[model samples]
Target: MYGTAAHNTYAQNNVGIESPTRLIEMLYEGVLRFNAQAKKSIKDGDIEKKVYWINRSIAIITELLITLDKTQGDISLYLEGLYNYEITLLTNASVDGDVAKIDEVSNVFKGLLEAWRESTNVA
Candidate 1:
């Protein structure tokens, strides 16, 4: 338990020291992970888990959307649209129990994550 607490603190500190790009990359990774869990929950017939994980993904996407610099012009607008679309997809997936929607969102996030990693030169 003590080791786990120490690890958590270390992880938090590491994140605090990361560049802004890396932080965004982390958010993308988080959304991807949550979406995967949501997909698995659906496959396992765990409705509660499905909703929880999908909601988690949506929340992260919301955070990303809110953090966007609208003053950045076209790119920010484009990202806002994409993030909104992903949130809609996630909401519909949760309501309809649609695995395909989750897959679609996951793919979108994966692409974004890849782009971020490439741009930031993050492993």
Candidate 2:
């Protein structure tokens, strides 16, 4: 409980200090991490762990979808579709224990993360 509270406080502080672009990058990183854990859990035959990680990935994607600016026109729409697709893929991976599905979603997130990093001129 203490560790969880400390972690939450750390996360809150980081979020408070981060720029918008950095926050988005962090979100992508988080989804990637969750997907990796989900894949590993599936490999280890740990269904509960797999579900937990995949659900986390899905939640992040959903958050991204919710926060999209509709005024951005085609870009926002495209992102919404992509995020929804990722959520679907993650849900399927959780249900079917499909490592390949997790891999696919992770690869998509990797590409997005790299693109975001390049756009933000972040190392």
Candidate 3:
């Protein structure tokens, strides 16, 4: 327990020290990872695991959507729409066990992640 607590504290500090660009990159990567897990769960016929991971992916997309800065202009608006659509896809995937929906969301995030890295020089 003590080691776990210390590790968590260290993890928090590590995340806290990153630039905002790096943080966004991490979120994008997290969504991708969760989407993949959700897709796998769907394929394996594990409804519970599918819902869990899809919800996780949706949660991250919600965070991204809510944090969009309108001051960034049209790009922010575009991202808002994109994130909302991704959430919808994930939600539908959760309900229907549709790996295609998950795949669509994954592709969007993968593109976003690549573009984000290139634009922000985060890597």
The superposed Cα distance between candidate 2 and the true structure at residue 78, in angstroms, equals: 0.7
| Per-model TM-score versus the true fold | 0.90, 0.97, 0.91
Task: Report the lDDT tens digits of candidate 3 across residue range 1-123.
Answer: 999999999979989999899889989999999999998898899999999999999999999999999999999999999999899988988988999999999999999999998998765
- RMSD in order of candidates: 1.9, 0.8, 1.8
lDDT of each: 0.95, 0.93, 0.92
Better of 1 and 2 by lDDT: 1
Model 3, position 5, has a per-residue lDDT of 100
Ranking by lDDT: 1, 2, 3
Rank all candidate structures by their TM-score, best first, as comma-separated numbers. 2, 3, 1
| Number of the candidate with higher TM-score, 1 or 3 | 3
**Count of clashes in candidate 3:** 0
Q: Which residue pairs in model 1 clash with each other?
A: none
Model 2 residue-pair collision total? 0
Cα lDDT tens digits for candidate 1, 93-113: 999999999999999999999
Per-residue lDDT for 51 in model 2?
97
lDDT winner among the candidates? 1
Note the residue pairs that clash in candidate 2: none
